[model samples]
Structure formats: structure tokens, C-alpha cells
Target chain A: MLSIQNLHVQVEEKEILKGINLEVKPGELHVIMGRNGTGKSTLANVLAGRDKYTVPQGNITFNNESLLDKTPEDRACSGLFLSFQYPVAIPGVNNMYFLKAAVNAIRKSRGQDEMDAIDFLAMVREKLKEVALDESFIHRPVNDGFSGGEKKRNEILQMITLEPQLSILDETDSGLDIDALKIVAQGVNDYRSPERSFILITHYQRILNYMQPDFVHVLMNGKLVKSGTMELANELEEKGYSWIEKELTAAD
Target chain B: MENEIIKKSIAEEYKYGFETKVAQDTFPPGLDEGVIRALSDIKGEPEWLLEWRLKAYHHWLNMKEPTWAKVHYPPIDYQSISYYSAPKKKTLNSLDEVDPEILDTYNKLGIPLDEQKMLAGVAVDAVFDSVSVATTFKDTLKKAGVIFCSFSEAVKDHPELVQKYLGSVVPYTDNFYATLNSAVFSDGSFVYIPKGVRCPMELSTYFRINAANTGQFERTLIVADEGSHVSYLEGCTAPMRDENQLHAAVVELVALGNAEIKYSTVQNWYPGDKEGKGGIYNFVTKRGACRGDKSKISWTQVETGSAITWKYPSCILQGNDSVGEFYSVALTNNFQQADTGTKMIHLGKNTKSTIISKGISAGKGQQTYRGEVKIMKSAENSRNFSQCDSILIGDECGAHTFPYIDVRNSTAQMEHEATTSNIGEDQLFYCNQRGISTEDAVSLIVNGFCKEVFKELPMEFAVEAQKLMEVSLEGAVG
Candidate 1:
């Protein structure tokens, strides 16, 4: 569903993602684990068309279309979604209103009729139950005064409602408690279909126990040095990332 | 490139700038006691009212125009402006007698005057430039012991009430511009709700500046007697002109014991072109006095236009336990400058006041909120809460807050909070990533920021204010 080849991304004149390559087939879940400052977020932002990052050398193809020329909105309309680590608090825009605008905008781009308020609200309430978010959240400001857990759960509600072809969950499990992690994992498991793909970027392996990834890749110093299955995640969780760093240094 | 996008976004054309073609009855360009007497004679005002106008004219002659506001504009030449200009038309005894051309103009402006005249009981007093053209629901209002008519009609028919309440709240000598307005004021609305009676319907007045180069100085007065209640709304619009038109108006509200008066204004005067060539210099003085114990007054205004706007609709809480509120949303875009706020004067025991102001400046527009809250020594246990917030869309605009608070009574409690911030890049990106356009995103964020003040507007005015904000800030960001 997504392909990245020799992606060299720079922010503030310094390349963060150096010569990185990855690919994920439809319905596959890819987990990219890395330490701090090792380009896990850089890869996610570059894929979602954030304007601050400049790509000098690389090409990204999503669903057989090049993403380099697309705007953030265009990329969003094309079923590419990025769940930010920290969502901004848009205080005056109601959560439900923002969701309707987003949903209608994407629908319009795909030649679909706009959803009326009554039908949209009914659908949104059902999705909110999947993520354990209260129905009252529809009236509140978007993430304004929300706890970290509530913000993540709202993100899951959005993902469930939009039903995007590909979703990049950036540190989705970092702020969740044990029960919230299980609920969030349940939401993802429920939404999974043969046509949907997910790229889970995280620093901790604790959430991996709840949701299984088809492929686990260890990212070190802007490059993926290891790729394997579920057992490799257990191996790294037992040993930590230092062993992988030392092995990379020995190989160099 | 970034600057270009911001500039393109704020270059929205003024859609209501079309001129209305009508033969004008304009006075010669000048200002003096003679001109004031001529104005009084034209309106057939009483002798005592003529003397009152002369007194205000003498006072205005000695006072200098204030330049202390945080706005810069070219000096206004009072001698060059014609103080009175009205469309030449015969007296209309009924709606059917009204001119078709004038009716079409209001219809095109989307004013509900025609629709209300056709249907139910919304009393409307339509003021065009220097005259009160048509007042609807006249007999219905009279049956309820409510005197709703033009200022001229009130002066002729109900001279005692007009003489009693005119300038009672904001006296003629109150300020520089108000003094001039009192002297040469042509026509506006006059509403009086009698004791123990609630007005049956909302009272509305629409002011339109259809004449070019003619200054608009209208006076509005409303008196709510003991145990009475009324909700009054005022709205204004002007045609586009090359020369700046001056508008100095005074509004006074009097609420007696246990009476409540709610006054709302949606002001959309012509705010000059992209470079701010020509628009109205809107200097208005509006104040309501809570005279009797337990009286309440609320002023809600949405100021969205004018090249330079200087207004402060205030409330004087002189009655024990009286309450006052000022809710305003002032938005300026593309070279407009506005310095507006409100005043709360607490003079009685246990009086309270609340002020919520939201100022939005986009493009090169500059907005300032200047508010004052005063608690006298006798105003024991009075409380005041003031919140002022500002949002700047582009880089060049400015927002300033000046809150002057004085509390002589130690028992009085006062709270003030102010905030100023730019549109965050992250907020825009977040919206953009959700497939929303940048312009729509800006509007969403700004509307959220102004939700507090918008809630105070009447239903239709709230929708108009929101759309006005969107038009003012459209394409102001990349």
C-alpha cells in the first residue's frame, strides 16, 4: 500500500532521514521502533506531507501515486492519515463540527454526497463507543483541556470514523494507561480489513504485546538495520536497543 | 511567497459598496448655531429643544476633537461636511405610500424590514441618512403603552417625554463628538416603554448612509419605566465613497426601578478599500443609566467595519443592586482602525458589571480595547469582571488592550483578564491535514476564539457576524 525509496528528509538544513527505504503491502501492519533522535518521527512526518520537512532525495508512492507533489490536504483526501504525538487544542471549534468538516471534505474530493448533521452525529456516536469516548465529547472543544488519554482516544475515534486506507499512528500508545492501551488496540483490531494498512511508530515495546505487527523494523541513526517478525520484538524487548546499536557500530 | 499569500487572503472586496441613487435634500456645508437652528426648524422641533441644541453647539465649539485614542487618521474638517442630508420624499402615512426605489434598496441589503412589515410584530424604525423614513407597527406599539416612533415625531407629539429623557444618560457636553451630534443630530429612533409593561415585540432600527459627503449625526433615546422591559437593536451600513464621511451619533437608555433594557448593535459601516482610501469616521457615544433600584442594562455590539471607529457604549449603575453588561466583538481587516470598548460606573451599593470584549485584527487593521470600570466609595460590595481577548491573523496587524480600573470601596471586587496571540502554524497544519482548506481553518479557529462574544448577539446578527468575520479574514493566511 505504501513505498519509500532512499528517502533523505531534512529539517532546518540538517538531514534527519538519511537514505531510508521501506515497503508495506495492503493489510500489513509495520512497526518502526527507534530511540530518541533516530528519525522515527521524521519518517512519519515526511510521509504525511508536513511542509516543514524538505526532501532532497527520495520518492514516496502511496497506492501507486507519487506523494511528493501533493499538499497536506490533498494527501489527506487520498486516504493518508497521520495521528500526531500531541494534538493542538482548537478551543472554539466543536469536536463534532471539525469532524464533519473533515469528513465532508474528503467525501467531496471522492465524488460523494455530503453527510447531514443528523446522520453524521448518529454515525459518530457509534464510533465513539468503539474507542470508549463519551458522547458528550462531541460538544467539547477539540482536545481543549482534554487529558492525554482522552486526546489519544479521540484520535482513535477519528481513525475509526474516517476509515482511511492507510493510517500512521505516531506514538499513539505513549500516553495511554494499561486499560486504555487495551481499548485502543481493540479499536485498531476492529478496524483492520484487507484494504487498510497501518504503520505504528513507537519507542516502547509494551504496546506491541496488545497489538501484533506483521513486520518489526529497528530504526537506528536514520536507517532501518533490522527487520523481522513478532519474535524479533520480544528479543529486542528483553535486550533493549543498546545491543542493536552496538552491533551496528561493530558492523560499521 | 508567504507574504504574498497573506496579502491575497486579506484583499477581499467590499460587497455592499454600491451607491443608492436618490435626490438628496442636503444642507449647505458648514457648522454653527445658525445651521443648528435651521436643522431644528426643518424638523419643526420645539423652542426649548432648539435652545438645548444651541447650548450643545456652543459647548462643541469650545471643545477640541480628541486625539488620544491609539489610532491615527487624517484630521476631519467640520466646516467642509454637510451636517444634514436626507432623501427627498413626501411623508408616508402607511407602508403602501413608501417609495418603491427606497424599498428595493432595503430589500437588496437583505434587511428584514420589508419582511417584518409584511408579517408579524417586529417594530422597525428605518432611518435613512438625515430622516426617519418609515416606522412599522406603530399602532400595535401604541396600544401596549409603548411609544415607538421617529425622534422628530416624538419631539412633535410627545414633547414632554422627549424633553425628559433626551440626553439624560449621555449629556450633550459628555464628549467632543457627542456634543456635535447633539447639536446637529437630524433623526433617529425614540422608544419609551411605560411602567409595568413589557414591550410586545423587539424594537429594531436600521441606519443607512445613502447620501455622499453628508455627515450622519443621529440621536437615539429609549426610556424603560419602572417594572418595564424592552430589547432594542440597531444596525448601520453605508455606500462606498471616495471622501471620508463622518458619523457622530449619541444613544441614551434609561431604565427605571426593576426595568431591564437590552440594546444590541451590528455596525457594518463602509470600511475603505484595500489601501484605506475612504470610509466613515465613526465616532459614537452611547450610554445607559440604571436609574431606579434593581434596574439592569446590557449593551451588545458587533463592530465589523469603518475606516476608523471610535466608540465606547457604556453603562452607569446608579441604582442599588443594578446590573450592567457589555459584550462586544470588534473585527477590523485591511487597513481599518478601531479603538472601542465600554465603561461601567458603579455608584450604588451591591452593583455589578461584566465586560467581555473580543478584538480581531487581520491584514493591516489595528484594534484596541479601551475599557474602564469604576466603583465609587458608596458602591460597597460591588463586583466587576472584565475579560479582553485579541487575535491577530497576519504579521502586520496590531491589537492593544487598555483597561483602567478604579475601586474606592475596599469591599468591591474586580477581576480583569486579557490575552493576545497569533494563529498558530501547528493549528493550521492540523486542520489542513484533515482535508480542510487554510482559509476555512483560519475561520474555524477565529470563530472558536470569538464564541464568547458571538453568543451574546441576536440569532440573525450572530450569523451575520460570523459570516462577516469569514469575509474579513478570507485568504489572510497561507
Candidate 2:
């Protein structure tokens, strides 16, 4: 349901992503393992249509529709969700208000009727259970003053609320304790459906214990250098990224 | 795309920009002894009251315009401004006698001048230009022994109370603007809550400036008698104009023994144009005096307009064990400028005060929060706390804080905290990536920033304040 081809992205006159290619089919969870500065986060941001990240050459398509031309909000309305690694604190906007605006915006784009406050609250309360959030959490400002784990769980709650067609988790596993990782992973597993797809961008394979992925890819030096099955994640966990670096050097 | 959005936002016009067509009889231009005497005569003031105006006029002449505020504006020509303009229609003894055209003005302003149709709990006194056109729900107020009417009407009907308390809190010569307002002030509302009687409803005054080239100087006074309580609301809005108009107002409050007064304001005067062509230069003085033991006074304001706003609503806690509170949310967008805050003067023993102020600046707007807390030698054991926060939406805008504290008594306690934050690009990107537009994101951030002060406003005004904030930042971010 998501495709990226020849993705060359730069930030601040420095190339961060060099000719990367990725593809994910419906109901598939593709884990992209990479070290810091390897452009995995840049790929997620570019896919979510963030500015200041220049895509010099490449094309991304979601559900067979071009995503390169859409604004960040438009891309989100098109069912592309990116769970930020660091959820920015929006001090005044309540989490519930933010979600309602997002939900209505997406619904408007999709020509669906807006949800009433009662229904919205009911739905949000139901989803909060999956992420272990309480009722008060929705009324608080978006991620303001939240702990790292709470932010990740809040992001997961948003994912559950929005129910996007293509979800990209940008190192959401970081800063999360083991318990939080499991809850977050449980949220993702609960949200999974045959019509939805996921791009799990992470550095470690610890979270893989909670939710299994269909494929694994290693990103290094701004490109995907290796592809394999779940066994690759175990191998990388045991051998470390140095093995992939040695293999790349040998191939070069 | 960014520039296109900026241009569109810069072109954003005032929503309350429409002028009402009415036949107006304006006083001759220029401020002099004759002008003050004529205004006094029009109100049929007592000889002593007229003498007070003359004294204020002389004091105003000697006082120079205060340029110390963190705002920039051209020198005001006092003589070029016409002091008064009133609807030519005869004074209405009742709602039926009120001219339909005049009622139409307030109607378009979302304020139904018809008393019976007004919000059940609010008694609105509609002030149009130089006159108080209508004061609604008088019968209900009268039943509660509350005297609510125009300042001019009070001069004729309740002369004793008006004379006893006029300028008692904020003297005529208190400051430059207060002196000018005292000299030729038009009509504003006067409210009196009798001893031991809580006001039956929220007393509100809606001030509108309709006449051109005429300055609107309204005087409001509210006295809460012993053991009484009252909440007062004042809202101001002006039509869009190319030539800058002037608004200098004086508001005074006196709370007697065990009494409490809560005064709120939502000032939305036209903030000129994007290039700062035309708007109101708002210079206002508002103060409350806790005159008796255990008295209390609180002021909450939402200011989001005016080309230049220079106002400080202060409280003088003069009674033993008195309390004072100030909560404000001041926003400036486009070419608007505002330097607004509060002053808490502790004069009585064991008095206490709290101040919370929020300032938001967007586009080319400049905002400043100037506050003061003073503890006198007599006010031993007095306590005070002040918090000032500012949020800037764009880099081109500015936010500033100036806080002054003076304590003569070693036993007094005072605390101050200030913080500055910006609606960063990352924050907006985060919201946008989640399906919210930039405009909605700005509003959310700003509303969150002002949530503390907004909770202090009355429910209806709080909703309107949020909407006003959103409207002010229409073109602020892209």
C-alpha cells in the first residue's frame, strides 16, 4: 500500500538519504533497522511531508496516489500517520481537541460526516484502554508535561484514534520502558487489519518480541543495504550493526 | 505558498468593520474651557461637578503624554479631536422610545438592545459614542436595591452617591489619560450594589464608537457596599477607519467592608490595518479600592485589539485583610501594539494580592506586560505573587515584560516569575503532520497558553475571547 523509489533527500545542504527504496503491502509490518544519522527518520519525515527536508529526487505513493505534492495536513488527511520520536508539546491545545480537529479534518477530506462530541468522547475513552491512558489525559494539552513513555503511549492512542491506512513509527520504541513498549506494541497489534500497513522505523529489535513483522531491512549510509526475514533481526541483535558495515564494505 | 498566505493574512479585514448609518450631532472640535463647560452643561452636572471637570482639564494640559510605554505611536493632537458626539434622537424613557436604527447598531453587534430578549442573566447597558443609549433590566436591578444606569443619569437621579464616590479611587489627576478622560468623559455605566445585597445578575456595558473624528472617553464607576458582591463586564468595539481615533476611559471601583467586586473587560477595538493606517489609540485608567476591612476586588481582561493599547487596571488594597486579584490575556497581531498589565498596591496590614498575565504577539505585533507590586510600611505581613508569560507566533513579532516591585516593610512577602515561549516550527509541524492545519495549530497553542487567564473570565466571554484570539491570528502563520 506504500511505495518509495530512488528517494534522495537532503537537509541543510547535506545529503541524508541516498537513493533508497522501500515498499510495503497491505497488512504488512516492515521494520527498518538503522543507526543514528542513517536517514531512517528522514525517510519517515519526508513521507509525512515535513518541510526543510528536501527530496531532490524520488517519488512516494500511498494507496496508488502521489504523496510528494500533498501538504503535511493533506498527507495526514490521506491516511498517512507518522509517530514522532519526540512528540512536541503543544501547551494550550487539549489532546482531545487536537484529536477531534484531526478526525474531522480527515473525515471532511474523505467526505464523511463529523463525529459528535459524545461519540468522539466515547471512542476516545475506548481506545485509551489499549494505551493505558485515563480520561484526564485527553483533556490535557497535547503531550505537554508528559513523560517520555506517556508521550509514546499518547502517540499510539492517536494512531488508534486516527486509524490511518499507512502508519510509520519513527523510533517510537526509544525512551519507552519495556512495559510501555509492550503496551505500545499491543496497541499496534490491536490496530492491525488486512486493509492497513505499517513501516516500523527503529534501531533495536527488542520491541519485535511483542509484535512480529513481515520483513526486515537494514538502512545504512542513507540507503537500504540488506533485506531478510525475522531471522535477520535476531542476527543483527546478536552480531550488531558492525556486521552489516563489514558486509557493505566487502560488497563495495 | 508562504508568501501567498502572508499576503492573504495581511489583507485580513476586521470582522466588526461595518459602520452604522445614523444621524449624529457632534460637538465642535477642539478641547478648551468652553468644550469642558459645554460637555458638563450637556450632562446637567452640578456646579461643583463642573468645577471638578475644569480642574481636571487644567491638570490634563500641564501633564505631558506618557511615552514610557513599550509602544510606538504618532503624537496625538488633542485639539483636533471632537470631544463628544451623540445620536440626534431624543433620549428614550423606555425600550419603545429607542430609535430602531440605534437598536439596529447593537443588534448587528450581536447584542440585542431589547431588554426582554437579552440573555436572562446579563443586564447590558449599551453605550453609543457620547451617550448611554439603553440600560436594560432596570426593574430587576431595582428590586435588588441595585442602582444601575448611565453616569449621566446617575448625576441627575442618584447625585449623592455619584458625588460621594466620583474619582475617589482614581483621582482626576491620577495620570495623563485619566485627567483627560475626567475632563470631557462621555457617558458610561454606573453600578451600585447595596449593603448586604449581591447583585441579582451580571452587570455588563457594551461601548461602541460610531461617530468619526470624535474621541470616546467613557467613565465607569461601580461600588459594592458592605457585605455585598457584584460582577461587572465591559466590552468595547469600534468600526474600521483610515484615520486613527482616540479612546481614553476611566473606570473606578470601591469595595466596602466584606464586599467583593469582580470586573472583566474584553477590548476588541479595530487594530488599524496591516500597514498601521487607522485604528484606535486606547489609553485607559481603571482602578479599584478595597476601602473597608475584608474587602476584595478582582479584574480580568481579554485585550486583542487597538493600534496602541496603554492600560493598567490596578488595585489598592487599603483595608485590613483585603484581597486583590488580576488575570489578563493580551494579544496583538498584524501592526497592533499593546503594553498592558496590572498594579497591586498593598496599603493595609495583612492584605494579599495575586497577578497572572499572559501576552501573545503574532505577525508584526508587539506586546508588553508591565506590572507593579508595592507593599507599604503599614502593610506588614502582606503577601503578593505575580506570574507573567509571553508567547510569540512569528519571529518578526516581539514580547516584553517589565515588572516593578517595591516593599518598605521587611515582614512583607513577594514573588515574581516570568517565562517566554514561541510557537516553534517543530510544534506546528507536529500538529500539521497529524491532520491539523497551521491556522488551527496556532489557535490551539495560543489558547493553551492563555488557558489560565481565560478560566477567570465569565463563561460566555471566555468563549468569545477564544474566538477573538483565533480571528486576530488569521494571517499570522502559514
Candidate 3:
């Protein structure tokens, strides 16, 4: 459903993503693991069409259409969702109102009728349960004064509510506690279907322990150096990423 | 890329900028004792009222225009402006007798002068350039013992009430603009609710300026007698022009013992173009007084248009246990400037006041919130709460706040809070990624910022205020 081929990205004259490539079909979950400052988040941001990160050379296709020319809002209306690492705090816009606006905006672009207010509220409340957030969370301002874990959970709540075709979670599990991590993983797992796809950008394999992925890739210094199955994550968890760097050095 | 969207949106023209075609009787473009006397004569005013106008005119000649507001403009030549312009067809006994062209103007403005087709529960007084052409539901108001008519008609019908309440709240010598308004005021609505009576319908006035090079000076007075209650609303708009037009108005309200008066305004005069070439110089003075025990007065305004707006709708809490409230949302876009707020004076024991003001600036617009809260020694246990918040959309815009407080009584309590915030790029990106356009995102953020003050408006007005805000902030996001 999505393809990125020979993608080279830069920000402010500094290359962040060296010629890298990946592909995923429908219903597939792919995990990108990397250390800090290793172009992991850059790949996610570029995929979501952030203007700060420029694509120097390469093409990204969603549903066989070029995504480079689409605006971030248009990309989102076309069913691409990115759960931010640090969710922004919009002071006076409540979570329920923001979600309804987002949902109706996308629905209108898709030529669908606006969701009824009562039905929308019911759907949102049900999604709140999967994220382990109480009813009061929907009434509060979006992400304002939320604890680190609650903010992460709020991101998950939005992900499930939007119900995008391709979802990208950028370190959503970083600040989450163990219990919150399980809840987030369960929410993602429940949202997984044959028609949807997922790209999880994270540093650790703890979240992967609860949810299975079809493919695992390791990125280092603006390039993906390794690709394997779930067992690679288990091995990396044991010996760390230095083992792969040593292997690459030996081959060089 | 988003900057391109902002520029494109800002290019949209003002919606209500069309002029009407009609024959008009306009005065010569100058102001003197002869002009004032001629204006008073044309209106057929009584001797005493004419003397009052002469007195105000003499006082205005000696007073200079105040330059302390946070605004800049070319010096105004008062003599270059015509004092009066009215439709040639005068003296309408009913809506049917009104000129069809004028009716068509009101229809295009979405205000039907015909009572049957008008918005239910609203009695409108459609005021053209220099006259109140028609006031709907007058018979019904009269049956309820409510006096709702043009100021000229009130001067001829209920002279005692007009004489007793005129200049009681805001005297003619109060300020520069107010004195000028009093000297040559044309026509506006006058309302009076009787003792222990509640007005059945909402009273409203729609002011429009059509004649070129002519100033619009309207005076509004409302009085609620003992134990009476009334709610009044005013709306204004002007046709776009290449030269600035002066609009100086005076509004005074008085509430007696146990009476309550709620006044709301939606001022949408024609703001100048993006280059700041032409628009309305809206200098207005509005104030209310709680004159007797347990009386209340509230002012709520949504000011979204004008090249330069300098106004302060204040309240004097005079009677013991009286209350006053002010809620305002003023927005400036595309080179517009506004300096507006309210003043609350406490002179009675246990009096209370609340002030909530919101300012939004975008597209090189500038705004200021200047308010004062004063407590006199006679006010033994008075209290006041004030909050002012401003949101700036672009880097070129500005927002300023100046709050003054004085307390002569140690027992009086005052609370003040202020905040200024910018619409950041991060916030815009967040909303854009959520599938909302940049324009809609800006509107959402701004509406959220002004939600506190918007709730104070009437139900119908709140919706219109939101839509007006959306239109005014179209190009604000950068």
C-alpha cells in the first residue's frame, strides 16, 4: 500500500536520510529501530509531509499516487496519520471538539456525511476505553497539563479515532509506563486489519514484546544497515546494535 | 506554502461593500452654528433641544481631539465633512410607505423591515445615513407600555423622559467625539421600559452609512425605570469608499432602582483595504449608569471592522448593591487599529463589576486593551474582577494592554489577570496534520481564544460573531 524508494532527505543543508528504501503491502506492520539522531524520526516526519524536511531525491507513493506534492492536510485526509512524540497543547480547544472537527473534515473530503454528534461522542467514548483514559479526558483541553504518559495515551486515542489507512507512531512508547505501553500496544493491535498498514518508529523492543511485527529494520547514521524478522529484535535486545556495526565494519 | 494561502485569503474583498441608488437631500460640506441650526430646523426640533445642540457645538469647538490612543491617522478636517444626508422620501407612516429602494437595501442586508417576515422576537429600527426610516413592532411595544421609537420622534412624543435622561449618563462635555456627536447627531433609536415592566421582544437598530463625504453621528439613549428590564442590540455597516469617513456616536443608558439593562453591539463598519487607504474612523463614546439601589447594567460588544476604532463603553455603579459587567471581543485585520475597553467605577457599598476583554490581531493590525477599575471611599465592600487576553496571528501584528486600578477603601477587593500569546507554527502544523486547512485552523484557534467573551453575547449574536471572526481572520495565519 506504501512505497519509499531511494529516499534522500535533508533539513537546513544537512542530510538526514541517505539513500534509503522500504516497501510494505496491506495489513503489514513494520518496525524501524534506531539510536538517537539516527534519522528514525526524520523518516517518519518526511513520510507525513513535514515541510521542514526537504526530499532531495526519491519518491514516495501511497495507493500508487505521488505524495510529494500533497499538503500535510491533504495527506491526512487521504488516510495517513502520524502520532506525534510530543503532542501539542492547544489551550482552549477541548479534545472532543478537536477530534470531531478532524473527523468531519476528513469525512467531508472523502464525500461522506458528517458524523452525527451523538454517534461521534459515543464512538469517542468507546475509543477512550481502549486507551484507558477516563471520560474527563475528553472534556479537558487537548494535551494541556497532561502527564507524560497521559499525553502518550492521548496520541493513541487520536490514532484509533482517526482510523487511518497507514499509521506512523514516532516513539509513542518512550515516556509511557509499562501499563500504559501495554494499553497502547493493545489499542494498536486491535486497530490492525487487512486493509490497514502500520509503521512504528521506536528505539526499544519492549513495545514489540506485546505486539508482533512482520518486518524489523535497523537504521544507523542516515542509512538502514540491517533488515530481518522479529528474532532480530530479540537478538538486538540481548547484544545491542554494536553487534550489527561490528558486522558492517568487518564486511567493509 | 501556507503564507500563499494567507495572502490569497486576505485578497478577498469585504462582503457588505455595495452602495444603494436613491435620491438624497444632503447638506453642504461644512460645520458651523448655521449648519447646526439648519440641521436642527430640518429635524423640527423644539427650542430647548436646539439650545442644547448649540451648547454642545460651542463646547466641541473649544475641545481638541485626544491623541493618546495607540493609533495614527491624518489630521481630520471637520469642515470638509457634510453633517447630514437623508433619503429624499421622508415621513413614513408605515412600512408600506417607505421607499422600495430603501426596503431593498435592508433586504439585501438580511434585515427585513416588514414585521411579518422579520426574524421572530426581534423588533428592528432600520436607520439609514441620517434618519431612522422605520421602526417595526411599535404598536406591539406600545401595547406593552414600552417606548421604542426614533430619537427625533421621542423628542416630539415623550419629551419629559428624553429631557430627564439625555446627558444623564454621559454628559456632552465628557469627551471630544461625544461632544461632536451631540452637536449634530442625526437619528438613532430611543427605548424606555416602564416601572416593573419587562419588554416582550428584543429591540435592535441597524445603522448604515451610504452617502459619500458625509459623517454619521447617531445618538442612542435607553432608560429602564424602577424594577423594569430591557435588552437592546445595535449593528452597523458602511459601503466601501476610497476616502475615510468619520463616524462619531454617543450611547447612554440608565437603570433605576431594581432595573436591569443589557446592551449589545456588533460593529462591522467598513475597514480599510489591505494597503490602509480608506475606511471608517469610528470614534464612539458609550456609557451606562446604575442610578438606584440594586440596579444592573451590562455591555457586550463584538467589534470586527473599521480602519481605526477608539471607543470605551464604561459603567458607573452609583447605587448600593448595584452591578456592572463588560464583555468584549475586538478583532483587527489588514492594517486596522483599535483601542477599546471599559471603565468600572464603584461608589456604593457592596457594588460589584466584572470585565472580560479579548483582543485578536492579525495581518499588521494593532490592538490595545485599556481599562480602569476604581473604588471610592464610599464603597465599603465593593469588588471587581478583570481579565484581558490577546492572541496574535502573524509576526507583523501587535497587542497591548494597559490596566489601571485605584482603591480608596481598604475593604474593597480587586482581581486582575492578563495574558498575550501568539499563534505558533507548531500549533498550525499540528492542526494541519489533523486534516484541517490552515484557514480553518486559524479560525478554530481564535474562536477558542475568545470563547469566554463570546458566551456573554445573545444566542443569535454569538453565532454571527463566530462567523464574523472567521471572515476577519481569513488571512491571519502566516
> Which candidate achieves the best DockQ against the true structure?
2
- CA error at residue B258 for candidate 1, angstroms: 1.0
lDDT of 1 by residue, B170-244 (tens): 888999999999899999989999999999988999889988779999999999999999999888889888889
Q: What 10-residue stretch in candidate 1 chain B is worst by lDDT? A: B112-121
lDDT of 3 by residue, A1-252 (tens): 899999999999999899888998899999999899999988988888888888889999999999999989999999999999888988888888998999999999999999988999999989998988889999998889999988888888888999999999999999888998999999999999999999999999999999999999999878888999899999989999999999999999
lDDT of 2 at B20: 82
Candidate 1 docks at the CAPRI level of medium
Can you tell me which runs of candidate 3 are displaced by over 4 Å? B1-9
* TM-score (2 decimals) of chain A in model 3: 0.98
DockQ scores for all predicted structures: 0.75, 0.77, 0.70
Candidate 3: the clashing residue pairs are none
Give me candidate 2's TM-score against the actual structure: 0.98
CA deviation > 4 Å runs, candidate 1: B1-4, B115-121
Models sorted by TM-score, best on top: 2, 1, 3
The list of candidate 2 runs beyond 4 A from truth reads B1-8
lDDT of 1 at B143: 91
- Tell me each candidate's TM-score: 0.98, 0.98, 0.97
True contacts kept of each: 0.80, 0.92, 0.64
